[model samples]
Target: MSSIARRAAAAAATGLTGAVALAVTLTGVPSALGATTGTASLGALRASTEVAVAAHGVNKEGYEGDEAPAGVDVHQEVSTAQLVEAADSVQDPAATGTSGTRTGIGCSGDGTSGNRVQAVYVGVAGQNDRYDAVVGALRAYTAGVDGVYLASAMEHGGRRQIRWVHDSSCQVVVDHVVLNPSDVASFGAERSALVAKGYDRGDRKYLLYTDAAVLCGVANVFTDTSPLQSNANNGGYAQYARVDAPCWAPQDHSVEAHELTHTLGAVLSFAPHATANGHCTDESDVMCYVDGSGVVMTQSCPTTHEKLLDCGGDDYFNTNPAPGSALATNWNAANSSFLFDPPAPTATLSYDGSAAVLAPSVPSGQGWRVDWTAPGCTPATATTTSPGGARLAVSCPSGGTVTATLTQQDGRTAQASTAASASGTPAPASSAAPTPTPGATANPGPSVAPTAPATTPVATLALGLTTVTPKTVAGTRVVLTGTATTGTAPAAGTRVALQRKQGTGWTTLGWARTSAQGTVSLTVAPVATTAYRLAAGTTTSAALTVTVTPKVQVSASGLTVKGAVRPAAKGTRVALVQHGRAVATTRTDAAGRFVLTAPRSGSGYAVTVAAQPIAQLALSAR
Candidate 1:
């Protein structure tokens, strides 16, 4: 065989498990294939190889004129045993079932909230058919990334799933972005076209699945390379990732995942085993770089782990890193908000006449509890006994106010309330006293009537319950809003106090009066996890918990990294992190201040404060 063909064979056997095979034939020139016996079948492969070579200088010979150095082809295919072991490491699906094929693309996670990764079908303007042939495969591919074993009878690990954009039917949502192929001939052009179509947003990571075969795939790797600023700002690059049609097939799942990981900020250039181009040098890992043209690759993890990320769990994507590990201190792709576990249990209250129904949105038979109070009645509690997102009913006889407080399994609490007038009718007006005629009061004989003593009218008040806008913060401010009502009417001008639970007692933090619309708002910056509620006179709303993550303010001059933690307390641990590695550690003095000197790596730095325990009162009771 020719030297080029020999290299091609080795690349197919060792480089990205299935990518090189799509780019080259085992016994052909690296750049192009001559007319062969199976000319018809090889036509598409030939065209793809030419595009990859012309666009990326990627082929069996090497990358950009660089030949593969000796001993570089060390990676091998993963074995069945290793695959089984990796599968065994995953958490079992809490429920037993397989999801049906998702037909259409929709928003991520119920389409309403959270950071999302939207899939876009970018095609040549004239192409018809929304690439429907590959949609199922793409979804299955995503499931595999979340640790599902494709060969198994039932899927598992609803524990972690790609937060893909999906429609109301639960089918994957893939938006169409058709452009003239000429306009997006390069990766930069592709991104520009997407931006021109208004795909740029901080909350989204756009995954572009293109029908064009310009190159295998490419993505922008946004990193924070500043010495002083927090690397958390790198979230601005959540906008783009692309997979070319030629780079993937129904049987190949890793390429799209490979490209998507780049958008999630993986394999930083400073990673312990990463190449100069931000790919790991370790083999048997999805994010590893084994193209044979750059840094020498090592077969550190067995080939079975080729489909997994961070084979050793130290480089980029560890779900739970050991204390003081690189992933524990720096950026970890697993921590990306684009991936999510099953949602937390939730309950919402709605009214059905005099009955207030507490409806829980949770998995079937998940345990839940609720405590409620009705007007002119003592508090009552109930728990779910059957299955599904069950509903509990509370009766309110007087129709003044009813509040239901729900408790999640993890002890978090949420409250809902409703107000309605009894009988849907207005109260009768009090009768006025009879006036005496001008001079007719002198008849004080036997038939005179006596007057009854006057009585004052009483009013009932209700406080509308709402949680903080952001239930969690990193030393930032959160806005709390509430509404007050007096017997089914807006309680305008009602004085309300914002109180935080403090050691079994409530402390007033701020006070405000209800607006003309009965709305009240308070902005607070809490340094620790705390329970808060709104109170008007003797009536208090249900508690809301706001969790605070310690924020580390970092500034570096020369080799010194100095920072302070908010809610400053003595002995707060601080670490200087860079390139997915923590290089220095120190403890704050009495003022929550700390300083450490680190070697200049020019790739930027991040300050991470060790998690400090904070006292919190449980907002939920059994």
Candidate 2:
């Protein structure tokens, strides 16, 4: 059967006939399910098929080949280290010190970079805050394909991040382009909107991440009748790709990377294992279509290879291809300019009035060091070190030009100086946003030059008692508000950081620039009872503890009651209390799930985890 007919039969068998939209595979073929391609009017495309969320248990979306691919002996099984690395890739840790603003409002890349994958989150207008999940998925996908982390556009502080169209107030701007319920499968509509928004640069490979429940993922493949050199097929043919929210996981054949692989010119028609379109017939390969091609897919590599590119290394991406080999002669993805191993380790030193904090960007297996000199400070000169340490803080009140030299274990050295200044009175809150403080400077990376002169005195900044509100359950965000002052005057434009107590030192969670009135309001999501403080330079607010209790999810089935607690820890006690008494008690299992026999006569029951109040649920006696 043809790919379209097969898709229709499957959709009908699964009762997903009307709900199925156009399936655009790597070949850019618009499935018979009703999608028009290449200069066809979009109105006809939208009218041809209904866009409904697929409720089938099986995910029928993604590449078109056939059957389960067979696993092979040569493919490496996933190691614990690889799993950990994959997990780390998706983690979005809070930023330290003052948060820097970016030029773009809602997206993550500047069109200037050479052949970079622009991370984009097509969130609903006026209703998103840096879709952290999308960012995490992109990071994970990039990390898995290449050892190096994906590079992003630099913000004000030299931090690489996603960019989208936003106004001066930092609100996302979507130009009447709807991709959610309406244009979910209208790839052309999305492409047009992005192009109108100045995202049509030929050098960029735009990774459009959307919450839309469209097809699993889709991208246009650039290919020819024969194998060509990697340089000849490098770019510009296909630039934008979509990875719907459903397929963002790194495990689903590394969906984002797989779609991107298509745009990167993989599995040429001339390749030995190439399928009709741009997919290979090899099993355990990310670019191999698992379903519709005439050739049945069989894994020639281990199952772990599903998260990788070419299976045998002879197809499209062998780093060191043998001479006269297909990969050596044709377009190779491993040689793409967009991919690279992680760069050398480097650190930055910045003195924010009250203290000098050294931040390092160290690659794997590398250590960092910081040596400083500030004559008037306590212990004028000292050295601090840590094994791949995240940050090091030093107390230096006499600012002036505080200089610090950082050396990586390999002996690569970089020096930076911050001209710290004394605290000044904050201007009254104005209708306008305060000028953003110049980002900290370092010799090794991009930095905004410090504004203060070298001879400026040390700042004596202090924070007032902070106030927190609305004690919340786990997974909810909380707000902390306070003000910074220089003596009795407001210290406007000073950078204030929110820090959490960890061990003996305070770890910076997130930071923001003080308002014109010197007030700062920071938001954080604490999973457990956490001690937090506000800091400006070395001065800090009184420690305030925010209490967070584990949230419980309870459901009743027949005579049995089952529930789970977030942050599931094995051995945590849970009790279903009735009339201020424990009626049923159980300990959470490793999955944080628990079960208890419902009392035969219970009408109202309160569930508690570790003696903390949870939601009240009514268990009906059947």
Candidate 3:
């Protein structure tokens, strides 16, 4: 039968919603046995005994709330009656298999009962006029296939029954659809609800098939083909199938057959049956390519159909197949061989100041061996049945590449590589000379021939300071100077600035640029006590301090001595001191008058005065 005809038939049988179900297996009661070593009474008693054992062992492990079993192995046989009885103990009678039934409505496949595949067909009730044709095509395609069964067309009851028939650990049911553009959101919501329920109940895997438009909208707003796009964009399972628009609806059944190939592809790609033997470019496999010519249906392709069922290059229906084919063929393919062995030990390699290097140990026993295919780097060798099971260690040689490869025993190899680059660190500051302090000079003599510009190779600019005696004159200013030379002659426009340290940061006070002779003189009014430094570009000169004293006067009344405020103003008050000792404390009566004995000439008498609070003034004399 042609693939299209078979698909159509399967669709018809399963109905519009594709709700067909499978039958559960049951075990029978055991016959009584005689005990020859016992007495005649004991033998009769034993002969009359009838022990009821489960036809099949049901593994409840890993089956949590609403979770289905991992897989059902039904190739082996036991009593159908016992299976039913066992199922009855765990499930309601309505969910149990009836006597002599080969296929139960809404039932799930059990590997033990020899049922491995369950098929369903999706179609719209009134809108899909081609439903019969589609179902007929599908049925003909799957004829005489072992472990495969077709679902009936009734929608609601069948879905519920399928869910109930399988134990929580083993069976999965996927809903398939071809959505119109307008129905995408509704379709997505339905799909999400199904997946959410599955996850809430502890089931990890789900299957879905939708049109390319829907899939593209769901997976990537920007890519061509994707499985995860449908599920993740729709917020559901990790995987899904997308049938290109040119294939299913409005097109021929050939496209439908191609989509069915995708259904088979998903099962082959995921857990319990995954293989590393295929690539997307492989024309011989349906899993490798999508079938169609840009939006238009043309001729049918047999190679396309053949690849879909090749089951990893082995002919369809082969009993003992290669791992690649086994994974690609059916959902129930055994995965025991896919297990990976422990990895080999690691070895340390040479180490540079910036990075450490290492090599991989050799794999001992074999199934598959790991190879560090990364150029100039090595990975630890290890045995594994699957890819990505070994470890690799490598340090990037300043701006280079590293690659890793895995070689299977069957000559099937896969490689992955990455690139590396170098990074730089900042230089540290100098510790030889002290940091230049604000307003200070490093030298103290009349400037000799000023050195060349600080940028010159021979002469570096340095600061010098000179004292300024306080005079009775107002507006007196002190000048600070620095010297510099440029190779043969100093460059002009050499600028310098002064900065004062305040709190945690520096505040700019004044600036001066040097002339062609490389000398700078800064003038400033001396304050009480201040520290400042001179800066030239990235370098600075040392720090210095200056002091200023106010004029003093004293008067006396008997032994008590008082000092008149030197400045004599509304803001100043006077206190008396004699022989360096304060004799009395008094404030001027707005006349700046305080009484005190006049000290002899050059006597180092001291006096104190408090200034008005509003002016922030205080004075001392010695």
Candidate 4:
């Protein structure tokens, strides 16, 4: 029968299932074939011709068709054992059946039950070699699912049987070149052969014809049983599964996952229905059809392949409740509770000048309150001052136990305590005892008198120097002031030296003596960067380093600017001056080159490069 006629007939018997109803349809095929084929005597010849025509239209229909002649004697039955053996040949080596003691292959014990999954392979009986790769990929990908069984039939078993394979633990079944070689027109020929067999039309099951013409894989899940009459009717391949044109990168696992998802979507009727020119591009879903053809083809569904599968969303995608719809929504909802992981408890103690305090804060999402208590002190309730900040204050007697308690928003509390003591005071300096002095004798005539040697006052002094500015220009004058004190006031001429710290010692720059006020100032020439220290008597102050940045002067010379017109070119030369002396010079080459040097100490200077004259052209400065 013609592809169209077979599809129309299938549509007419939509939703019919079971052996009782199938038997009635099988008995009517011969009569119908007689009318459609025209010559009853040449039934075999007519059947062969019909198969050829249908196989040619297989691509047009988007699936491989059965190529058997209508009345030609062909094997229709195969033993269950033979089917199992055939399937095992194509089975994935990794797939294993459930055995309680079989370490990783058995069902997990975490409430998923001991569902056994088996793998069986069905070999290809057709001309397409791609089926081998496709089947292999399916086996390797679905090895983790429960119970996979492979089966094969001498004749096509149709869409209902295909749906059964997907719905059951049977991971996949492969069929080789079922299309007629002579009939290479539309793919509808393949669909026709399946419809001729007692295939179920109620559950829209589709076949993907991944041939040379369509290098990309194809997927179809029909909501309605009249597979041929659906939008898949056009030459575009309707009742049609989605088709991905062949791509060079067969490693594109996302494409395979996407097609498989469509199959799963079909069984669940979860994918959006094809609409508007037999295409659905609206909505940010993987199921949405994309526009364009060839290698650069775009898809209507949101490309979650990278985010969902590549990231950690594969499990969610595999068990998507909505199937063909947006998988992201369901995935996010399932993992909402695990979005943010709470951080562990962390406590930090810091001193604000004189007080030692402990501040504890938890993550914002975790509602925790902090309370503080101390021995011989008042306990304070913890309060949340900010989204993530909790404040707890406690007053304790000197040398007491301080405890901090953390209460979670869920009403669970934990406490941590530490023993602490008040800081001690510094001891006072001791006073020196009075010293006794010798006295002269009384009642003596013309006696020799003795006098004690003149006492010398101890000269004790201290010096300190500070840098008012951290950075300065070369040759900039810097002030160094020093204050000196003595045990009995300085002799008014004690010298204090301002020195710079060298490699391992101090080098005195200059020296000054203390006045009656015991203070002195020293002025020194600033050359290179230096660190200064003040020395007086036996005391030396901390070192203070001051960095002296050089002053630079950059200038442009021999600048010639034509007019701002066509072919207008300008040339300029530049020279660098430092400390009242020319240091470097350079000329412009096509563009402009300038010389840069450090200037003498005085504020700072900058040179500008202009496109036109100084007043009219754009200017750039350095």
Q: Whose TM-score is greatest here?
A: 2
> What lDDT tens digits, residue by residue, belong to model 4 across residues 1-622?
1111111001101112100001011111222222222123123322432211010113233333222212211122221112112322222211123101000111112211111111222122443223322443333233211111110010112000012122121223333434444322222333344445422132223333233332133333222111121111111111223222121112212233334333332212221333311122333222233221321223333332221221222222222233343433222112221011222333433221112234433321123444555556443233332112322233333445555554433233445555443342211211111111111000001111112211333234556666566576544556666666556454365545566765676544334567787767755434346788876423577877877543322233233222111011124433333333334444443212333433332222223223211222222333
What are the Cα lDDT values of the candidates? Answer: 0.48, 0.48, 0.28, 0.30
CA displacement after TM-score superposition, residue 185 of candidate 1 (Å): 1.9
Error of 2 at 279 (Å): 7.5
The sequence of per-residue lDDT tens digits that candidate 2 reaches over residues 425-513 is 11122111122222221112212333333344544677864555646666567778878888778889775656677667665443467
Full candidate order by lDDT, most accurate first = 2, 1, 4, 3
Quote each prediction's TM-score. Answer: 0.39, 0.50, 0.21, 0.23
Q: Candidate 4: misplaced stretches above 4 Å?
A: 1-135, 141-171, 182-185, 197-284, 292-622
lDDT tens digits by residue: candidate 1, 1-622: 1112111111111011222211221222322112221223234334543222121234544322122223222122121122222322222221223211111121234654556777787767753323433343344334444332111111111233466665543445667768886655655566656666777665667777776544555654433222111232133333466656434421212555666676666566446886544467667666665444555777777665555567677777666667876667667666666765533434545544423444444321123355555655222433332121123333434555656554433233556665633443322211111221110101001111112211323456778657545456444567788889887789996767677776676654434678999998877655567678987644678888887776556665667766666545667677766655777778986446788777654554566777342221111111
The per-prediction CA RMSD against the true structure, in angstroms, equals 27.4, 11.8, 37.7, 33.7
Runs off by more than 4 Å, candidate 2: 1-259, 267-457, 463-467, 496-511, 525-527, 533-543, 551-573, 579-581, 586-596, 602-605, 615-622
Candidates arranged by TM-score, highest first: 2, 1, 4, 3
Model 1, position 545: C-alpha lDDT score: 84
Which candidate do you rate higher for TM-score, 1 or 3? 1
Name the TM-score of candidate 4: 0.23
Which has the higher TM-score value, candidate number 1 or candidate number 2?
Answer: 2
Q: Is candidate 2 or candidate 4 better by lDDT?
A: 2
